[model samples]
Target chain A: MKTEAFVFDAYGTLYDVQSVSKITCEKFPRHGELITQVWRLKQLEYTWLRSLMNSYRSFWDITEESLIYTLDAVGVESDAATRAQIMDKYLHLDPHPDCHSALDALAGVPLAILSNGNQGILDTLVENTGLDRKLEATISVDKVGIFKPHAAAYELVEERLNVKPENVVFVSSNAFDACAAKNFGFRVAWIERVTRKAMNREVDEAEHVGPSTMFKLLRMQMEDLGMEPDYRLTSLNELVALR
Target chain B: MKTEAFVFDAYGTLYDVQSVSKITCEKFPRHGELITQVWRLKQLEYTWLRSLMNSYRSFWDITEESLIYTLDAVGVESDAATRAQIMDKYLHLDPHPDCHSALDALAGVPLAILSNGNQGILDTLVENTGLDRKLEATISVDKVGIFKPHAAAYELVEERLNVKPENVVFVSSNAFDACAAKNFGFRVAWIERVTRKAMNREVDEAEHVGPSTMFKLLRMQMEDLGMEPDYRLTSLNELVALR
Candidate 1:
């Protein structure tokens, strides 16, 4: 397809969620899990709710809102001290082990990190990972609150990177992030990592049987692209090396 | 609100996503992440896509389809043996630590697991987690392929649990799942836990935001129930201890 540039999704893909999580998670050993639980849950909810309502906010502001709601829900006193700590940590999250190497490998081509996050958050993320040196573009929808899959977000990358969605290799650990890029016609890659997902089961209440998740959407896209997954799976480093 | 019973959202709320993920992730390290990534991405996409396209399949089958496509995308081969291995694992997932104990605490109540999963898959999950042993009902939307947020799936729970929407306290870790339950007039509880959420980074994504998340949806619900978070956190034992 003559792909020239690789566009990456921020958060889980480039940076380790655990790394950012460690910021607040390490503080309150008691409420650490709950805090992250609230932050992520609300962060996602904020995005979806914004989309459905057609409202928009930068990921940073929403992150704050999520934090606020999380605190309130958990009955934690919403003090400036706690807020500052979280924001500071969030702003300087560490990069995934594979991030720098991957960015370094794709050094020559135009590479971008297109996120629903604001420019500030994106920059901080890249800078924290120290991979900012390699990026050709750092795109974010600062003016809009709309997230990915909305077309507008990807359009920013399209405009900034100046590459056909079809010719750009978009990567993310998030399935929906990839879906947005794929739907936009970008050649997307999902960097799936084994996260230490919590094992707290408050209630195995009603289980979900929704449609295939975003991750599955990529599968459908791969079939259309004639891409085949290797039965022999390898670590991200190895896979990236082979690629 | 004269609530009759509380129905919970299963997958993200009560049960861990790993149940289905381990099916593939264990066999293929990256495959687990890829499977979860794809499955989640596609599942959410399918819901929105089908909602937009006006066609639907049971969440279970959709899960399978997404798996096939994801396997192909990542270049992972899902032969009969591999597929069965992954598929069978769904029937034997280990419950989260808090699952059994909480189920034990809520034993006397008319608790149920409502999902859009296939009858067989849900049945198998129930057996695997030994969840059925603690609950009064296990509801599935097999008769209707339309998943959560769809009235039909909710109806399955309502019909089986014999609880009116308001009378029933619906618990789910999924924001959309909780929102839908609330929309259906059920008293919903967003289970607070640490789980990766599928997002496109939109602010409005909050529509589906589960109450229990980085913040603590459970705490929010507890507030609704006139209960306080007063240091009541952790496993079922600790939670009940507060009570």
Candidate 2:
């Protein structure tokens, strides 16, 4: 009930997949869509499979497996050479529109990114996202050798931040993770990008999926907990109200 | 695998959560959103919970329970009158765009709808979507007292169709059901909506889910000894191609 610090799921929560996909996607439109969707699907699958298989790989390594597996699943038949570009992009995604400033707006509240990736990958992400200096710390599952909802990954944040699960607001873009964390007794927040792609030109009227962005997700999380932000903003200026 | 028939999971597979929400979502748009989301979250939860409870309710009854539970979960302040309207609209949801024609096209395939719903509600849906008459038969959990992905529900279809599991082509919009059926050894066809829904300008894009007609999901059950669709359709019309 006492959320002193906030913990976030990195991949889909803090960064956007579509944005990450820009490298490959911007080059080949047809391949771009499949690349992002399949890569993401495989990344998640590998994370779970590694846990299920009792083998743990760093997020960077898993990114490789994800690319390979995604290509195989979709029958894209990519060679390792072409796949390196896709895997490499994972380290350099743009921070979501409101990311840094939004965190900046959180006043001095400690913020952390917990992931099922490796420390090296997390470091790269931090550097790319520019959160290395802004946020409190970064946490990854490599320490526990397990993915989240496993209690281990969640515990990693607890151990690192010294914040109890109830005191840490957990935000994740994955639905099952929210369900898992909530069930595990964390005051959880759902980032709401449940499915793979944004449904893009597919459904301009999808009603549930598309370009709502994470602002609403963050808003819903705040509303669910009855914690009104210092102020709501379309830009970093929203963070100003906190100051 | 020889498929004598195809089975579909209702709510998310053959239909969608927002599709039904369209009728009942106006009351407390905010609460309505939670209600719809949790209503869905609970339907699956109820099925799983009841499965674990070893006490079962028809999915229809469970849906009602979920809706009310969702209202409570999100703190919806609605009176009895509003609740009644939402409940009625649930069974009256029209099929997504091509549902009627899709059913008409699948005539020879001997399809059946297997839902957690009660027979009465199933009958109402059949009458409402008109997918009722076109379907060869409708099977509700009320008969067997079990929900889907449960081995028994799958068995009901096999028993009714007088075919082996390998001989059934299972179609569902619920991705999990499709995965479940595929894992359970049925020929699974995913009905991916390839259509798009234009935004209703009156609705803010933030609230706009976008796209009434969306890309219907389709994963053709393959020749792989493992996954096969046997048939795929955007509208049921593709069923004619089965011949």
Candidate 3:
């Protein structure tokens, strides 16, 4: 496969979204993990819901809104200070362990992040993680006023990068993103961070699974939406082999 | 409000979707509640997702697919016969206790169902529940090839019923549906079946909430999507007063 550019989904593919749990737990005590799980899920849902409604809000706004909803849903009273403190974590999300190495291995390729994140957040996040040095561009759905899984959102990659869909390897840990990218004609590599065996075992063994495990069960697995990714990888480190 | 028509959302509004839990419990033992919750969530998600992806599958297909995914996620093995037996429950979903009385109260008003369900399933469900006598039309997204929250889906009501959006009082128990219908210019009545106080109490009192309660926590509340329903009522019977 002659992959011309590697376009990654930032939040889950290259950045560790679960890293927010550290801060959430610190602030909310017992409710941290649940807030983290619900916050992320609601964040994604808002994007889809807004997209379907043709109501375009910036990803930054959506993130804050979803956070507020999550706090209320989990019975935590959130003030301006608390909300601001938690929201700041998005700008400093820890890069996945393999993120730097994988980018370095494909150093010569035109690497960029095509994320549901707003450009300001994406830029800050990449720079904070020292990934700005390797990444050529940090694309945001803000440019198009819609979120991922929408065809126009995927089209932003080709529009900005000057690459055809077939030549770009769109990588995402989100099953819906990978499916949509593939459906939009990109050569997709779905980073399967959660394995099927692990998922089944978690469900079988745990009488009451925690928020993180439940998140994996609901969101991490591949969707049955007819579009399958060209490659199913366990980690971003595996992307080097494809390069 | 000179109400020209009353268009109801079928699932969770007129029909009690949770009633499927009875059969799911019978079929999957302890996993039934989880299956029911996950199944409903996934089913709504698939609609939004497929709509955004521009890949329109009939609601029936999406329902079955979500059920299969739910069974797998919950660590239950499902075969074709098992799937069929469980799916059959959709055709005969129990009407909410208030459904008939509410419809009956608005005697002379033109009544219909505007649903994401496909025509075949909607017809059978309405007929099986004896709602067909009161309903002049069972409007499915099948006619428009898209699901709710999309303006196009709501536009079908005006197209078929010859009723303008402002004159039609769109009633739904689904918050998202109510918001979308209101956003599309209808006089939307959101049936608040799960009260905010009840939801908060459920979260505060329970150590680990059940699937049904979790569904209420996650889905039953009004969205922060800017489009609020014109009226918020605790029961369908309250809708009669608005008429």
Across B147-207, the per-residue lDDT of candidate 1 in tens digits comes to 5555766777666766667667666656556655665666655554532222212112433
Regarding TM-score, does 2 or 3 come out ahead?
Answer: 3
lDDT (10s digit) by residue, model 2, range B1-243: 455776777765566556656645688664444346545644664565454334566666677766665555344466778878888876776566656666666677788888777889888877787676668888876777766655677778777767788877777755445655776778777664432121112122323222221111111211112233444555545645542
lDDT of 1 by residue, A1-243 (tens): 676777777776676554545666566644555467546645765665455434466787778877776655555555788688877777776677777776777666787787777887788767766767888888886655567656767778768877777777677666555545665676666554422121011111213311122212232133322222221211234334333
Model 3 residue B93 CA deviation (Å) reads 0.6
Rank the candidate models, highest TM-score first: 3, 2, 1
- State the lDDT at A183 in candidate 2: 56
Candidate 2 lDDT score at position B155: 73
Q: Residue by residue across A204-226, what tens digits does model 2's lDDT show?
A: 23335422321122112222212
Local distance difference test scores for all models = 0.57, 0.59, 0.89
What TM value does chain B of candidate 2 have?
Answer: 0.78
TM-score of each: 0.51, 0.53, 0.98
Prediction 3 TM-score vs. true? 0.98
Judged by lDDT relative to the true structure, which candidate is superior, 2 or 3?
3
TM-score of chain A of 2: 0.77
